[model samples]
Target chain A: MRNNDGNLVFERTPYISGYASVVGKKEGEGPLRDYYDRIIHDSYAGKDTFEQAESELMNTAVRVALNKGEFTQHDIDLACCGDLLNQCVASSFAMRSYAIPYAGVYGACSTMALSMILSATAIESGAAKRAVCAASSHYCTAERQYRFPLEYGSQRPPTAQWTVTGSGACILEKAGDSHNLLNHHTELKSNIPPSSGDDPLLKENHRESQTPYLHSARLGRIIDFQITDQNNMGAAMAPAVVKIGIKNNGIKHGIKP
Target chain B: MRNNDGNLVFERTPYISGYASVVGKKEGEGPLRDYYDRIIHDSYAGKDTFEQAESELMNTAVRVALNKGEFTQHDIDLACCGDLLNQCVASSFAMRSYAIPYAGVYGACSTMALSMILSATAIESGAAKRAVCAASSHYCTAERQYRFPLEYGSQRPPTAQWTVTGSGACILEKAGDSHNLLNHHTELKSNIPPSSGDDPLLKENHRESQTPYLHSARLGRIIDFQITDQNNMGAAMAPAVVKIGIKNNGIKHGIKP
Candidate 1:
């Protein structure tokens, strides 16, 4: 087992096999636009309110990621995820329909990283065979809760960021030795015939590609330089982000930042 | 390596070595009154605002728990804790004075349980030598955020329980076996002399009492039964709490609920 203790990086044996991103039309119009699995026409996505729409994004994103991984809902051991909602209603409400176990986390905009770290550790420690890390945020929902209501039409300050209306999910499966990054979860029996058998997905011709590995994860500690500016979250998150990036860089690539 | 996988209970070896709670005057006069270690004169705790008072309570609780454990700040690896505050500012701001790492968490009223579980798991997994699990809530802080300000004096239905202005913390130490519940952290050595030596604290006559072990921890999945009553958090939380208690009972004692 990889040592996942007493350090920033959770060096675990988890392979990120499949992923999906569901974005709003505005995000679909942006760069890296073609990469998203699906994009809805509006923020509401036919829901009555922005919160419902956010939940829809999360639910759809999970399904899309599962489809990409060729795994069904029953195959996933748990959904370790969160969002920007108070009480994390977006993820919790979406989870009521899902039969799998759930773990709701909160880390503001950095919640996805937190989810990924938790899933990796859980899977590494044999708490799960597979886990889905998901997060979502809608412009309307976040604005009204954290700042001004849509009806107020408050002007955005220069440091203000437009809350992205999008959701992303990724399936992390337990991995094995370094020589075989393609090693899947032991419990998840494979469909790949044999190393020598006729299978184009794993054939010698298609073996050039790489499996995305969770080399290590640097869990972030809370940090604040006392920037009490309510309008500028960037200032508050800057120190923590910088610390994470520096530590992760050193762990992942033997270089001290 | 006790198995903490798939099952709700984290059957780790952590003993709840120490704990501390600080509450406002109103809570001090209530049911769990005798349980808390310290009760402030007012909600503000002589601070300028309710937020500051809440932070002071958290900071004081950590110190109290540490003192009870006879461990200093440097001995703690992390503080796995949070509060009902937005962005978990109460926990984060309170932790800044201590040099140890902080893990901010949120589970509404169930935050204390979350803090305990996380600290236990981290300790069992060897991520921490010593951990402090903490949580707090002030009536004024939560009321204004989730409902009306205190000045409004909104009439409450019987079902609407008053938000307790209180904070609680616990120190979970890894237990070696059934016999070693009182064994402290490895780093916290030398303070305790041998049982056969000249220390009256560990004399045979005074060894009857046992420290309660955290036999297991069951993480509760979110269960929203479509009751969207903002004022009735008790209603929203009842299902989750019941689910947790039943599962924990089964896992810890095999009594099927």
Candidate 2:
């Protein structure tokens, strides 16, 4: 695919074959709570520290994702992981038990998307047959690292986005795989049924991901816009997200593309 | 490619098209000092905080690498970065100025290798035409974040590795580009002449990087042998490095492959 601004063009597209997610009590109580695979009753998840809880969450998510994909630790070709920790210790420590090749990434709240894009890129290129992309965020851990400790009981702020305790893992497989996992009504809400073994896209025999393929993406540029209020993450991230939307959707002013 | 353990072997290898390095005054005194491109007199790098200085080091390294590869931020499909600081502030702050789609990664001291491998994987996948991998380490920042403040002047043990200030950036293009840069021995001693039209790797290739390809790699597993010696990085990292050598070079025990 080509674009007027030369963005959103891809050489090879890939697919999201399998995915799993684990969330904390707060997140499970939220709007899309029904979609979560595992919802812990407490933030600690029976761990001693918030950090440890986050790590356990990630491990469980990864395990669920692997099981969903019908893969074992040894089958993970690439591991993209991160957390909101100072050095992403939660994800790193959780990966200790696995023999998967790993790439530890950091993107604050954007980490989920960052890991997904990278996983897609690797599978798209054929460097990896299966890539597990994961990220976790714990409210207590985030507070201790980025702000004040919850022990302080700081005053409420409406603009602050709650850092719900949650961990999500998604598996991306080689695009040519027969299953075409994205067709299911998962996060993206596509309802395409299983392949009949006679689909035209599959028949073409090109090395492209099946329906719901990951197309060329417009890499986001950091646009600070000098927003000093860090509490308002949506404001800070709006510019980049809008840029991506424009590039990918090519929405013209006052009109949808 | 499949191993006895089932690690996904890549069928398409990528190339290391270009690379650049920058070090602080202390590291300029090290053994491989001659290979570094720029050596700052101090860690401050004309910034108020050591943190900012570290960010500047990354920016300088990125610029140097971009110069060697003849690429602008526009050409980069993705930027993978990491540092030792909390949330990888050094690299993240540096990337604020570039338009490259970014993935901030963290692996403590192993960040450099982690970034390189991730970059190679992305480029090898063909999801990206070009990827920039970079990492930075500053003694002051590392000391403050991981252990103690530099002012503490804590007692040193033999196992403690000095945190020298340095940053490196490498550009990875699609594996088949003709420059075959790795074949040119800049640091390895010989200065291969610039590309000539007659070079075979350069011919019949629309977009293959020159020689010195990132042929293959084994993603390292986190092997915690219960060694609590934080300073003894060599022992903690030795197993993973050896595994990589055995996998990549096919070296055998008691005999070189």
Candidate 3:
């Protein structure tokens, strides 16, 4: 349902049934490394080109997510995916192996959020029974395409942000249907190596009531501060995020901001 | 609603309220040029870069479409746009001036159809009241990014396809809402110079009964024939098109293909 402030409150909330993530060596060494399902030690991930490596990363994530959900590509109604590459080649190439209907999306740094929102909307609207969403960005590919190549050894500005060579995918299904599926398939398997002993999905309560559900989504409007510095994308995007946050807060409290 | 064959059949159909197109000089010389609302004589479109020129083309088309629909950006619930540029920069940059919630999509040659389908689904689901969908491509931009720079004077193969420098935008609204708005605003103005004396929107019957409405949309699955020749994209894409066509025909005749 559309709210007065333009937020969409889904009467039939869609829930995330399964998810998986893969990261590069640099990201594997970070603090949140244990949360990822797989980590590739090689930058190329056995691929000749960085572009191909990114596609492989996305493909692996999608496959693992499907395995975690105990559903194959034939069960999915649609796939929404994107990447930072030109024309979103990584996503297009990765999705080619799967016969599911697809929609390619682009939102730069916010691609993950964008894909999830679209997937949720599709499920909530009864347009699809299940949807898979994925997004990826490779440091080597992004650096050369959007900035100076790594081979050039260009000096980085303090404000410049590093792009992660990583991919994440999730399977979203209707809440009611997710419960039925969980009851039918009790033997869950992790396609990738488990990062820790406390895998959340393994917990008894987690399978019962802890699966995350999407309540509502507030789409963002484009806001520009006229910042010309390409190195300072954070500044260009902060204002828009702030605007959405304030509006969301106002809506929660039933007050006009 | 989801069909047995994965096609979406909208019970509450969405109708096109307005649309406009802009083309480059080369396209203006074509036979169907009169259908376009405006044509840019300059290759750069008075912009400093070819990328910006493409963005300008898309922005102009969007504005003209809104004007024809007798609506403003505030009336739109969402904007779905995409282009051939890396990271979809053309669409992202073009949509920044508007405050409408935006979703950037990418589907290579099928971006236009993809955007329209998503928009129709959003309106049909009641997630959005109105939507604006657009797609754009520039000859110079695509030539340099995807193949070779124009300055290189590269030779073309027989199977190579020339990318058109053009943009089109359309406004979609709920079928019931469109009739109400059309009745309220009877005097519609064309934002760009009229190419011919017979403007379709100007006809009385056109406004009353001839407007187009979306009935159903079948999303496409990615298909690869393993043809690695970049110059022969038609060969790579034709098989997928034929598969969808055959499936659609079978569905129409109530026979399984």
Candidate 4:
């Protein structure tokens, strides 16, 4: 149901049963390197073009997520995907091999979040039993498309942030079904206590506490503060983030503003 | 709910309450010129750039649709929009002024159909009370981005289809609520017979017969026939459409193919 703050409260919470992340060489060298599932040392990821490389990254992420969840492509009801490309060709190309139904979304920097929300809604509304959400971006593609080409050797602005060459994907399923789906995965099965017998309720409760569930989502409105400087996108987006953060906080605390 | 054929059947039907279309000078001179709500004689539409002109076209379509339905910006729960530009900047720029929650989608040529299906799902699932779906494309933008620049005066292939410069917007609402929403519009009100009187049931049935309702939707999977020729997109896409069309036809006829 929609609250006064315009947030959607899911009646049937969606759970992230599996997830995977893949990054390029630069990001693999970062502090969060160990968190990723795979790292491609080459910028091209053995692909002919930067766009194809990005598509490969996303394809790897999706495959890894499905493997972790012990689910096949046919198990997924929908695939909500997008990327930072001229026409989001990365997602389309990556998903072409899989026969899963697809919906392509474009939200630039917010694409991953957007895809997750759409997936959660699909699961919550009974429109989908399981959905995959994925997003990808490559630094080389972004630089040449939005700025000077790498061969140009242009000077960088201090305020400009480097785009990461990476992709992440997650498999969302109905909350109640998580226990049955994740039972075969030994790592997750280890979370269940030996003393807790086959009482389904207790096991479900234990699994619920261990797994992450999406309870609600609040969609953001476009808030343009008119910061025309492309180099300082952080500053331009700050106001929008702050506005949404305040509204979300208010809704959580039951404070009307 | 999903059926054996992978189509979503909406239990609560969604209705198209209002719609509008806007086109540029070239389309205005076409045979269907009288069908459009508005036509701009200038390619720029008083905007400084072709990109901005495309945004203006989408903005006009959205406003005209909302105006016909007598809906203010606040009445819209969500706006699903996209375009042919890089990063879909045309949609983003056009939606920046409206405070309605937004979801940017990218399906290239299938964007409008994708948006409408999403809006229908949202309405049927009670995630949104009303949604505005809009899509736009400018010939100049498409030509410069995907092919040669307009100034180049490049030759065109015989198989190439010219991208029309236009925008279309539609508002989807709950089916039962359409009678109340369209009551103020005389054009639709005249559809009801004067003898119907105040019998609410008869009025509703009459309205249902006159209006269009979304019964079901089938999402398509990406199919690559590996046709590398850019000028013959129709040939590349024909197999996918035929496959989906046959499946839908089978479902309608209750065939278990």
Give me the candidate number with maximum TM-score.
Answer: 4
Selected candidate, larger DockQ, 1 vs 4: 4
Compared with the true structure, what per-residue lDDT tens digits does model 3 show for residues A1-257?
44346676655456678899999999999999889999998999999999999999999999999998888998898899999888888998999999889999998888988888887777755678789999999999988988888899999887788889999999987655653355423344223122211334434333565677665677787888888776777888888877875666455757666
Which regions in candidate 1 have their CA more than 4 angstroms from the true location? A1-12, A176-209, A229-231, A247-253, B1-12, B176-209, B229-232, B241-244, B247-252
DockQ comparisons of all candidates to the true complex: 0.27, 0.48, 0.56, 0.55
Q: What's the lDDT for residue A233 in model 3?
A: 76
Instruction: State which candidate, 2 or 4, has the greater lDDT.
Output: 4
Which 10-residue span in candidate 3 chain A carries the lowest summed lDDT?
A: A189-198
Q: What are the TM-scores, per candidate, against the unseen true structure?
A: 0.82, 0.82, 0.87, 0.88
Sort the predicted structures by DockQ, highest score first: 3, 4, 2, 1
In each prediction, how many residue pairs overlap at the backbone (N, C-alpha, C within less than 3 A)? Answer: 1, 9, 0, 0
Task: Write the residue-wise lDDT of candidate 1 on A1-257 in tens digits.
Answer: 23234353333446676789999988999998999999997878899999999999999999898888888877777687778887687887777777666767777887887777667666544456678889999989989978888889888888787888999999887543223244432222333222212233333322444656554555566676888766787888888766756664455557776
User: Taking the tens digit of each residue's C-alpha lDDT, what string does model 1 give over B115-201?
Assistant: 776666565444565678899899898887788778799876777667778788777764432222444433224343212122343
True contacts kept of 3: 0.75
Interface RMSD of each: 3.0, 3.3, 1.3, 1.6
- Window of ten residues with lowest summed lDDT in model 4 chain B: B189-198
Q: Candidate 3: what's its TM-score on chain B?
A: 0.85
lDDT of 2: 0.71
TM-score of chain A of each: 0.83, 0.80, 0.85, 0.86
lDDT of 2 by residue, A67-134 (tens): 88787876777889988897888998889888877888888878887787777666654556678889
User: DockQ: which is higher, 2 or 4?
Assistant: 4
Q: Model 2: residues >4 Å from true position, as ranges?
A: A1-13, A176-213, A247-249, A252-257, B1-14, B175-211, B247-249, B252-257
Best by DockQ: 3
